[model samples]
Target: MIERKITYQHSFIGQQFIAKLDFTSQYHSLYCARLKSLKYRCISADESGYFSLSEIMEVKVNQSCLIAGIIVCTYADRSSIVEKYISKIGILADRKQSTFYNRRKEEDFIYLEDESGRVRLDLKQYFDWENLITGLVVAVRGVMRENSVLEVIEIFYPSADPPRPLLRKGDEFICFISGIEIGNPSLDPILLNLLSNFLQGNLGNDSAEVAKNIVRFVILGNSLYKADKENSFEQKAYSDISADIVPSISKSLEFFDTFLAELAGILPVDLIPGEMDPSNSSMPQQPLNPYLFPLASRYSALRSFPNPYECKIDGIHILCTSGQNINAIMQFIDTQDPIKILELTMKWRHLAPNAPDALGCIPMQDDDPFIVEDLPNLYVVGGMPNYQKLVTEEGVHCITIPKFTSRQQVVLVNRFTMESETLSFVSVIQGMNNC
Candidate 1:
């Protein structure tokens, strides 16, 4: 087979040299340029050893530059690129120059020799040669200068490495109430109305309050569902009647007897049997009457800004610093108001154990002081839930109020946290109505 010789001028010294080339068409169209003495240098390694030197000449084409005069050597039968040359003349005469160096070896280096008689060239330091060699091979565009030795004057490494990708943030998850079971008779109507309003998106100013009420409603509903399941007729009957008719009927009187008996052990006073006289009724039965019980008997000075008549009867306030105490309070509330007959509000504080203060004072004439502590705040009232912790930095404490019945309780519950922010509550209520 006939061997081809690749010829190019030794631009470094303005001389001509011929290489017995085994060129691959696969690498055709690559550009090349002459590199001066030390203008650009590369540190490369092969099986023999590692070395560093400047690029003397480059084969320039429209598309890419081919690094020429690279000597290839073979060991046994395996072919590889050669790093060291006994003399410059031998490199120009080598046949397998491309495959002479150990391309896999990290210590191998390729050196470019410039021919004599070329213009003297100014070059960067040896250390910068690494970047220059890579810059040329990657086809980076830069300035060129002709001196005593031909060289790449300016070079870049546009394709020397791969690019990186960007990152993004993650999403968060939250849970909400969907439904509840009603067990407590007093809480039923209020809770029903509240839920109705909530589903309708009419729970104004009371998102949290309504949430609390929903919790209470859920608890009571669960209780009633359980009672109904257990066939607890007496318990079921007590919760079945409306607030107005309940207080006036003989059946209510009997149910109250049983209820007081059931509550005798925990209650402060014995449940007393009262006469069912309509004429003596202090309050008339309204569809919304169930919601008024907590306000009338339990909450003190319970008043809305535009309307002061809002109150929750048979409500309970809970306070505690420890989760255990909070759980205890919730358990107590759950048992006492099984039907969730009371409104519940919870507040958490970092302070040592102390009694909870009234959120507001009830009017003297309308107040039922006996149940003041049991008015508005109910389950998990005074302390953070087991899952929640107190944050002392801003002296910020959390309060949760569950209105077992009234949708308005949602507004009131939120009021516990956001004192005067009427818009949030109003918007929520409006949204509920729209929904």
Candidate 2:
């Protein structure tokens, strides 16, 4: 067997040290140099050019450790060492191999080398190795020790660059954070401003509504973007409209009430209650009961309910039914006005066979008949044999009412009845008339 002599030196936090030794030599010189730079007190070199920390200060046995150093030289099967150490610059490289073990041993440990020199790392730390390999630079801070082959006390990745002040853009970042990488920098400004404004509540007065509208816009925009990759005119238009409207809308409870009322008038009555105000002989004061209609004998009967579909009180016409076919109803109202009808029937087609006896026909006030001046001469007829045909009439439209198949219909109807009862209670409490 032949022996080789090696010499090495290292500096840490401004202090410098040196070491000289004889070992089996092969690649031991490079390994020794790295270990020396780590400031390990005692070192031993092996035939494979691997070096171990024979002793270290302030270190205990069986304790985990971290070691880091720059690669000096990585030779072929034979070992060699770099002669000089440059402070600011360090070389990066990696290598891997499998080792055979005797039957007595269950497995062989894998060895990993980095700027910190060599250490036998567990398989679980594979990702740490990968990060190092992918050019992710890290500074590790760990415990230091001697008396064992490993020199590091602990290890961690440190930020190499100086921290910069984040640019302001509303409440969001105008620039990506340190770890976050942006593929395209062009949208940074817009994203920043939008985020900042959102954070500052400057986007709109109705924060919740504005947020909902923004989310809706984003969803619709993304859908459109997917469907039309090249052009998003519809998406742009919707965003523009929402951005403009959301800022102007008041955030008061009254605004919400009014908004809900307006939406209810246009939507199905069953889906949203109190959308329409009951007819009044004269102009009523504030706090109107938007939902003021008698319950239909049967759910299906709602279809045959008269049109213009709305009745006027002191010239203000209000819709009476919350039938499912709101779009058709609205169209009918739009096309005709001063609608008149006689003998209208409200049907409940979805009534359960076992449902309680149907409520009989109910009377309507003189002002309760559906009549919309905005629409052409129109009439809504319920309980009339020609109601369906009237709905299909030229300039007049009809929507076929759907029947509930499951027992769910009964539950829903019962729920509505209960809700009406509750509303009556509320009205009584508020000293409002329940007509």
TM-score of each: 0.18, 0.16
Per-residue CA lDDT of model 2 for 241-336, tens digit only, reads 334333322222233233224322221122211112111111110122233222321232111112123322122212222221222222111121
lDDT of 1 at 186: 43
Tens digit of per-residue lDDT, candidate 1, span 43-77: 12111122223233442222222222221111232
TM-score of 1: 0.18
**Per the 3 Å backbone cut-off, how many clashing residue pairs does candidate 2 have?**
49
> lDDT of candidate 2 vs native?
0.22
lDDT of 1: 0.23
lDDT of each: 0.23, 0.22
